[model samples]
Target: MNETVNQPTYKRQRFLLSFVHQINGSVSVTDLQKLVFLHMMSEDSNYYEFIPCKYGPYSFQLKEDLDILQRGGFVTLDYVQGSERIKATGDFPTGYFFRIPTERGKALMRRAYREYPYYSINSEITDRFFQGEELEQFNRGKQTYAQTEQVLFTIGYEGKSIEAFINTLIQNNVRLLCDVRKNPISRKFGFSKGKLKHIAQTVGIRYVHIPDLGIDSDKRRSLATLDDYKHLFEDYEKTLPSKKRFLDEILMLLQQNTRIALMCFELESNMCHRHVIRDYLVRTNQVRSVDI
Candidate 1:
């Protein structure tokens, strides 16, 4: 039985929709955690505990939850070779894949948005998502300031193609790449601070490594307790003011002409501290994240 069945209908809807969106292709567990959290935040700004998945103790029952979504026909899971090579043959090798709802999912979401109008999250001006000229101005001018505008926003990273993902930001001419990894050196590509810095520089993007944005393992341990995990999570929430200060110090370095992206190992923002930082920026600086 799907334990998520007992969760409020909106919570389930938010989780499944975000999960399906992230799994449109291959995705790592870390990526899923981030995506789910972002969705929850968009639905409700105060919502910050993670979905019940393997990333953390509270979200450890991933198999069961995924099973529920699978049974509902909301998603399909398969293990493939993990990569694909395309050619004129038109036949591709088998690889890991998570087939997610396309048009049908969007249609359902539209209906849900109507039926559960109260389920919609209304973030304060500081929590609004960024779009259009606001984003353009932020990236184009140095130190140019805009009053904070509250707009609904969500962070999503896991998707079909990595090159496609990178291209989105490049096409937008995003200028700065903020490396929020504590170590800045990873065993993987696109994460190690050095490699990412070089790549972003080559693409005309400035890369800045901010150790403060890295998840504090000690702090995380403090957040996990036997008694439901909510207490510790809330404790972490209280520290945001300091975190915001640190992030602002970093942002202050931007010369009004910079567009910044906080990068970490997790593909989704929710699973990582970057989302919290993103929230702080939106609420405090009027800066918002767009899907790029």
Candidate 2:
């Protein structure tokens, strides 16, 4: 119950370092499980949350890690909340919390490094599976979390011109825009598929429209049996075969090129299939999403 009073033991430190190192940067809990699995193979402690920590578990969740990092002045969480369907939903904004080691944290790492010399080990291990940008991604993940303030913006086509939106997307260096609307066409003037695609291409953004990913209106209505959107999401997850297909295609696209944004009608991802897509990506692949 009282974590700080115990201080971090050497066993805890070693396990933590190994867990953090395995993550390599930002990670979701599912990916964290895989990393833990690799580190604690054939060990009963591997499922510590379901079992015991002494044997292995090293179970880490983003919120818990974030809390520890925040206490250490290492990382801060930032998110935007948007109102949709009379409810407020949270979404990730521009970059996530800046992840860096604090001075004290760095001192701890240095001492650990002196003892284990994992950097050299990692250099060799990384050389086997990565190069260039991939290597950078792998290395950047090793830093301890750091907190920083984040700015949140609301989504609206309102007073802004579509050209301006396109320009803003370009400025963000968005590489691929995966349109997840069941129907990519916008009845509203200037938001139609032809115009959006033309504009996106003209600005050097690759656009691929996937319609099957949209929320089924009938299904949503039927599922109105549930009051909470989270429950709706759970039902959607259970019934939607297309969502799984969408994820498979997205993963294939990732293998082709990692940069991509899941686009949908609701500009805020939390209210759309994009949120599900984003969650699946981060949970399964450790990919980051930034709302544009």
lDDT of 2 by residue, 89-185 (tens): 1221222222322222224323323332322222324434455875566456433211122211113343344644554554444556677666667
Deviation of model 1 at 22, angstroms: 38
The regions of model 1 sitting more than 4 angstroms off are: 1-165, 218-233, 253-255
lDDT of 1 by residue, 200-292 (tens): 554456767778656556655554444534454355567777776666765664435355566665565655566666766677677646633
TM-score of 1: 0.40
Which predicted model would earn the best TM-score? Answer: 2
Tell me the deviation in Å of residue 61 in model 1: 34
Instruction: Point out where model 2 deviates above 4 Å.
Output: 1-160, 220-228, 240-242
TM-scores of the candidates in the order shown: 0.40, 0.42
